[model samples]
Target: MKLILIRHGETEGNLNGIYQGIKDYPLSEEGKLQNLKLKSKLENINVDKVYYSTMERAKKTADAIFDFSSSAIYFEENLSFNEINFGLWDGKDYKYISKNYSEQFQSFIDDFKIFKFPEGESFKDFYNRVSEGIRKIIKVSKEEDNIAIVAHGGTIRVILCELLGFNYEGFYKFNISHGCYSLLTVCKDSAVLEFLNK
Candidate 1:
């Protein structure tokens, strides 16, 4: 079976550098157009099913690509894959965070796994959330199908870690951009990355 992971189109938080966390936010206007362009780009692929995060941005992207025409289109909250809860930092810009809390900002850049944003979650917590969704996908998918998942960048990084056998500390090295795509082929023993950030 093949698994395709796609990050949702840009959000207002993406453009503004705000920590969106698990809060519900719609896609920006440019995001919608980006998703439509992505749909046009992927129109030829034989996608058997489309699965997406319940977050509006992700769902909107999935709808643009698959149009919910196949019964295989599913919105899974588990797949919504929560962002690292930013807590008090949720609405702050990166520049503000870096200037006011230099050490914390450096921790995020230098050692994300250990960076804790006051009341927010650790990277480990976010990793496990994506892991659960991965497990579900592996158990349910047929050998012949190509499954597409529309989720967040954080979620895509976890999928990359699992598929590429990357250690916990290297998660930040994988850069899945907004509206970018990845392809993972799953066999009996392990998963192989075919394409990344395409």
Candidate 2:
């Protein structure tokens, strides 16, 4: 199975340097243009199945691909591919979180896997969710199938971490640019990373 993971485009939260984990922000004008380019990039590719988050930003990105691709999409937000919920930090900028809650921020920086947001989920929950989602996708798809998934940065990171054998705490070690796509090949015994942050 070949997996194509496409991160959602930029958003107002991104322009303002705010945390957008589940805040429901839409794509910015620049993001729309990015999606246009992304659409053009994948317009001629053959996709067997498409999956996307329910969030508008991701959905819109998937819509662009759908408008140009030859396949329909399946929603994964209600299943296992939604963005990590930043909870109280949603819509807040790094400056605000660091200034108002320095200890929590530092704790998160220290140990992302264990640090729990005030009302948010731990990284473990999200990691497992993404891992399961990818496994399920692979399970349902044939080895020769090409699959596309439009999701958030965190979700993509988790999937890559699991596939690449990186720890969840090191999710920051790699970057997944907005509107960028990555390619992965999964065999019955091994997984190969073709490219990342593309």
Candidate 3:
């Protein structure tokens, strides 16, 4: 199987460096342009299925591919692919979070792997959810199927980590840019990264 992991185009929150998390935001004008470019890149590929985050940005990005690819059977929206919930931090800028929730912010900076957001998901929980989602997709997909996943940067990074056999601790090591996609070749027992952040 082949996995085309796509990060949705930029949203207003993304351009302004706001923590969007589960808060819904549509693609910005620039983001739409970026998606168009991505669409062109994938215009000729045959995709079996597409799975996207329910967030507006991801939906819009996925729509581009779905609309262009005649081979795409269908696209499904999955909450498991949503960005990590930021809870009270949603829509806040880093400066604001650092100043207002100083202690929590410090703890997050010190050890983010174990830091749970106020009323939001912990990293461990988020990883497990995403892993389960991937497992379900793999379970139903054929070995020759081409699958595309349109999601947030955080979600894409987690998917890459899970599929490429990277430690969760190296999550930030991947530079999943807006409107970019990576390709992975997967088998029953192993996966190989073909390309990244294209």
Per-residue CA lDDT of candidate 1, range 3-36, in tens? Answer: 8888888998888878777665778888888888
Q: Which candidate is the best by TM-score?
A: 3
Instruction: Write one digit per residue (lDDT tens) for candidate 2, span 1-198.
Output: 888999988998888998888788778998888888888888777777788877888888888767544335443443478898888998899889999899899999887888777698788888898899888888878998888999998898888888888857568887889988999999975789998866
Minimum summed lDDT over a 10-residue window in model 1 is located at 73-82
Tally clashing residue pairs in candidate 1: 0
Query: lDDT score of model 3?
Result: 0.88
| Candidates sorted on TM-score, descending | 3, 2, 1
Candidate 3 versus the native: TM-score?
A: 0.96
Q: How does each model score on lDDT?
A: 0.77, 0.83, 0.88
Native-to-model Cα distance after best TM-score fit, residue 73 in candidate 2, in Å: 6.3
Put down candidate 3 lDDT per residue, 74-168, tens digits, no spaces. 67889999999999999999999999999999999998889899888898889888988988999899999999999988888888888878858
At residue 122, candidate 3 shows an lDDT of 94
* Candidate 2: segments with Cα more than 4 A from true spot: 68-78
Residue 100 Cα positional deviation in candidate 1, in Å, after optimal superposition = 3.6
Best by lDDT: 3
Better of 1 and 3 by TM-score: 3
